[model samples]
Target chain A: MSKVKIESEKCKGCYLCIEVCPKKCLEVSKEFNKKGYHPVEFVNDKECTGCGFCYQICPEVCIEVYK
Target chain B: MNKILSRPESLTLIQHSYCPGCGHGIIHRIIAECIDELGVREKTIGIAPVGCAVFAYDYFNFDVTEAAHGRPPAVATGIKRVLPDRVVFTYQGDGDLAAIGTNETVHAANRSENITVIFVNNAVYGMTGGQMAPTTIEKQKTATTPFGRDIKRDGYPLKVCELLAATGGAVYLERVAVNNIKNIMKTRKAIKKAFQNQIDNKGFSLVEVLSQCPVNWGMTPKESVKWMDDVFVKHFPLGVYKDI
Candidate 1:
């Protein structure tokens, strides 16, 4: 299975990763960070391909993917 | 498995003040990665410009100096000349580099100063609220050109790479974008090469990044990326404009 880690504090909540993810395993959290933006969460690690597309598309460089 | 992605050590830990999805953060990371990978962080001296990236000094982990508006190239030239052993570079935006600093840029390139320039061409005066910039495409709507830029009045977009290529002082000049996975990777490689050229004592080198300004462009981040690829790319035409 693949896993994704997010540094919530670094996330700007642009959500570009969710839009580009092929697996749809990520979702925006209801909680807000210090910046008051909803950080994204990995909802289903089992569905992740670890393709690193999310890692590539993140402008803030806040996401990590592990296979 | 190992850590796949993390903030580069060359970048400070402070959260960026850039708007969400701004390209400045990505570009900053790329520059930091290049410096780290090249093991030149300690020797790198970055000159921050007077635009959205004015706060670059706060984000970079190494020594950083702020230059006057549209004067990074000139400032970088002075620093690099004095400290030839250090890795000197300038981080500038479209408004600062191509508009007000046009003369500085051309003359610096003409002098073949051994400095790396990372020019972010987002097509608007971002810090000043989306005013028309020299890099703004003709017919693009900006605060100063609300009805779309007229070619006759505004002139055409300034092709920095092409302009610098003609000066012969620029030994390496490439334009890259950061909208997709492949392009982002290419941008990283391009940045590294530009810095490497400076390290090798080559003449002036510049990497013009065709970035997206979502807030200024009045579009979503995705739409801004799309427009950059579809419309902006057509005008700029990415590739190595000059290489030696």
Candidate 2:
């Protein structure tokens, strides 16, 4: 399964990654990070193509992509 | 399957200081990725401007130096002149480039200094509380321009790429945006080319990135990007202004 790991501690909750994810595998977690922002959580149930679009668009470089 | 993407090796472990959804981090990553791809990180020297990216030296792994407000091009020119072998580039924001550094920018480009320029044009003076920059679009609301920028009084936004393209020394100039995935990819390509031009001794090359200042723009990161697509691009269209 393709997946992207998000560094929750580093995420600023911009959601740009979620906007660019083709697989709909990324969602905002209810819990806030150390920075007081809602971090993204990967939804493993969905199949990810590992397009890396989220990786390219993430301003904080929080996502790491794997296929 | 293994890892498909990760942080560029040219970047440090320090987290970016830019606000969420700001484009500096993204641009910084793109530049780092390009330097890594070109295998020039070891010899690369970045000239950091006095703006939101003042801490650019901390983010980039290679050698980086700070320059006065809007003086990066001048600083980069001296560095490149002194060490012709090292890859030198300057990263400046709209206020630093088109405003305070306008003369420096014009002369550097006019002289065709063998240095790469990464011009981030978010239209406002982000670090200074969203003051009206020279590149701020017509009638755009900025901190100084509460009633919106008066085109009759303030004049049209300066098109840096187009302006520099007319100079004889500049060999390449491209304006790009980072609002969406396609534009982000295109921006990456443009940045790589700018670096490549310097390495090839092809004279001055500038890549004007239409970055997003979500916090300063008083909009969500999402809305800022959308506004860039809907309104910003209308004022400053993207594409190569010059290539020779």
Candidate 3:
């Protein structure tokens, strides 16, 4: 299974990845960073197909998928 | 491989939306080639601004995000912050960066955000029907400045590199043109440096390319290059403004 990691400090809360994920494995975490923004989180890594759609759509380049 | 030419896998085969002989095509090819050479096509993320090159998303093989007018910097900043491991850059035009999004560009650089900005300055606005742009030279005629751009009224042309370099956040800044083979080579080098700066985690690199918009400039493609060499270069001298 592929895994996705988010560098919490860099998340701008664009949430573009959340909108494009076909697996719906990502969401904005309730936790806020130093920038006072809710970063993205992988809700279900097992559901991730790793199609890289979320990676492609993310403007912040925050998501990395390891297959 | 010739870095100046386009790679089949890196670029879409469709005809570009830019005007005949417009520099955007050349700029696009150079950028795509760089991405291909770096083997970052899959890992690179590009932000396209709203301008003549708005369809830039269609040209590159890598993943792309369409940013609101003048917002590519902010979008790229967000992306770079989140995905520091990935290479992120923005392709913007004068009207998008220097005019409406000037604040965003300035602050992004001021913050030394780890992102690359490819700023295309063609003087007049290309997509919006040739209005006077922030980089349009004084006494130049455009749709909005039919009589000629009066410096006193419209203000002076914005020298982006000079302005951005003054900020401590910027790590690399260069101004190059594509009017000739020599300058085109220089532009490619500058662009490569800008991207490498980001890869090295250098903050806020920008390459202001003096491009041509023949249709908007009301000149033939050939004449536009001549105009750029004769006129535009006079106002925007070509050279590196900063590198660290």
Candidate 4:
């Protein structure tokens, strides 16, 4: 199984990851973290291909993808 | 995996936007090489500032954030505080750091933010028309300072390393130039140390690199190096100012 993890606190809300995700599995969650910013969340892991696009696009290095 | 001259995995294939003989390219390559050598390409987050290098996000293979002019330090602060395990760095120019963003740069150093700063001082502003910068030397003519920088009117060149060293928060501070082969090697070492400091959680670290601006300085590539060797170094002496 492939999974994506978001370090919510580190997320700067750049949305580059969301834009780069080919599968469109990630979205800015309604819930805000300690930074008071809405971080991204993976709504469906099944759609994730583990392409690492999101991992690469995340400017804050807040995302990690494991296959 | 650490090889000199070999391109770093963190750098993208696209060529930089800097002009021919520009020092920004050299500084960028040294930083990318250092990141590759440290094997932190995967964990490093770079904050791109608004300047000639504003498009740095396209050049680095690693994750990158684009911050407004002189705001890289503030953005890096937010990123590093949250992702303490990851390495965060900012590539800023003299116009951005010593001029408009002086407050952000100073406070970030005063707070000892756990991050690395690569300060490129090319004496004059490159992105915006050739203009006088905070680090511009006396008697240097720019588009704005047509009659040469007047000492009484224009302030002295800002020595970033000297200013940052006064703050106890900074763990490592060095001023280096990339005008020659020997100096390039030293600049690489200083860059590596700044990144190492971040990894060791040693607080803020900065390497002020004296760079050449042939396009803005109105000099040829070769002339730029000579100018750096003759005039730039005299004002911004190269050396490690603080190491802890």
Candidate 5:
């Protein structure tokens, strides 16, 4: 199984990854990051196919995928 | 198992200062990735423009120097001439490149300067409160053109790649967008080639990236992307305009 690690504070709440993701493993968080934006948070990794679609579309470069 | 995707080595840990969903961060990451892959992080010298990416030095871990508005091509030409073995590239926005630095860019391309130019064309002046830029599309609304750009008054957008293709010195010229996954992949390839051309002593390569400015464009991040894919690409078709 692959895993994704994200630096939540670095996210700018763009959601480019969440929109591009096929696995639906990412979702918007109610809590705000240090930047005061509701950055996307990673859900359970069980469904992560590691297609790398989210990582590629991420403008923040905050997501790191380990396969 | 190893890490499949992470931050590029050439990029610093400092978070991007661009607006949320801004395309500058994506372009920066890809440029850093290309530099890392080329193994020229130490030898690479970047000339930053006076646009939203002015703080590019803080984000890129490599040696980067700031240039006056639209003067990166001139500065880069001088640097590349002095350090022939070093890889030099300039990151300029449309306002800086096509408007303020038009003469500088044209002359550099005419001279076939051995440097790469990364031109980000979002069709609006992003840094200075979303004013109209030289590349602003016809009938596009901007701060200066609240009602929308009037072709009779403002004229049409400048076609940079096509204009540069007529120059004898430009060895390569390509235009790509970064609105979606497919376009982003093509953009990465085009950017990497622009850098590779410099490393190979190929002269005057420019990759025009059609990026999005959600805040300035008055659209959500997703809407901005949709605008880029649907409308922006129609005006500036993405493809290699020249290759030698």
Candidate 6:
């Protein structure tokens, strides 16, 4: 199984990852970071195919994929 | 446990100094990733340009040197000649490479200096506010050109890849963008290729990335990416303009 970790502090909430994820496994979190942008969350992790689209699209390089 | 992806070892733990959604962060990571993959950290020397990426030294974990505004190529040439075995590259913005440093860049390419140049073209000068740059497109509104760029007065947005390709000494020249998932991946491949060219002793490889500037463009991060795709990419078409 692949695990997706979002580094909230480094995330600028660009939502590029969420838009590119084919599985729709990511969503904007309700919480806010110090930068006031809503960090994305990994939802339904089991559905992740680990295609790494989110990791590739993230401008801030805030996502890490672990298996 | 297997790690599919993580921060590239060539990058430091320091948070980037760029504003939110800036392309500099993305480009920095791509360069760092290339360095890590090539296992050239020890011998890699990155020359930071004078514009927005001036702080590139702080981010890249490997050896970094600051060069005068638009003078990275000249500096990089000196370093590469002195330390021929080292993998040398320069990170420069449009204003630095295309504007003030044009002469240096042209001559370096003509000489076929064994160095990689990562040219980030956001059309506007990011560090000093959104001013008109040599790469700024026609009729594009900027701080200096409020009403939009006048072609007759300001001249056309420079096609750097095309210009450099004319220099027979340049072995590789590509224009890539980071506006989407596919393009981002292509951009990474391009970066890696440019670096590999240096390791192979190829001369004068330059990758012009059509990056976005959200804060200076006065748009949100998402909007900026879209603008880069729709407007910016039109002026600077993506692909390898030359390969030898």
C-alpha lDDT score of every prediction, in listed order = 0.90, 0.93, 0.82, 0.83, 0.92, 0.89
For residues B1-244, write the lDDT of model 4, one tens digit per residue: 1111234567776756676567776687778878988999999999998888899999899999999888999999999988899999999998889999999999999999999999999999999988999888999999999999998998788888999889878889999987766687798899998999899889999999988887788887667778898988998899989998
As a whole number from 0 to 100, the lDDT of residue B67 in candidate 6 is 92
Instruction: Identify the runs in model 5 with alpha carbons over 4 angstroms from their true place.
Output: none
Against the true structure, what is every candidate's RMSD? 1.3, 0.8, 16.8, 14.8, 0.9, 1.3
Q: Write one digit per residue (lDDT tens) for candidate 3, span B1-244.
A: 1122113366775556665457787688778767777777888999999989899888888889998889999999899989999999999999999999999999999999999999999998999899999999989999999999998888999999999989999999999987665677788799888988888887889999998877888886667778998999999999989999
List runs of model 4 lying over 4 Å from the truth: A1-67, B1-4
Q: TM-scores of the first chain across all predictions?
A: 0.96, 0.91, 0.92, 0.93, 0.91, 0.93
Residue B48, model 1, lDDT:
97
* DockQ-based class of model 5: high
- Please, what are the lDDT tens digits per residue for candidate 5 over residues B90-135? 9999999999999999999999999999999999999899999988
When candidate 2 is compared with the true two-chain complex, its DockQ is 0.88
In candidate 3 the C-alpha lDDT for residue A6 amounts to: 72
lDDT of 2 at B100: 90
Which residue pairs does candidate 1 place in steric collision? none
Could you tell me which residue pairs clash in candidate 5? none
User: DockQ score of candidate 6?
Assistant: 0.66
Ranking by lDDT: 2, 5, 1, 6, 4, 3
Instruction: Name the 10 consecutive residues with the lowest summed lDDT in model 5 chain B.
Output: B194-203
TM-score of chain B of each: 0.98, 0.99, 0.96, 0.97, 0.99, 0.98
- Candidate 2 lDDT over B89-183, as tens digits, reads 99999889999999999999999999999999999998879999999988899999999999899888999998998899999999999999999
Full-model lDDT, candidate 1? 0.90
Residues A1-67, model 4: lDDT tens digits: 4678887776655465665578898997999988677888988878877776665434344466767
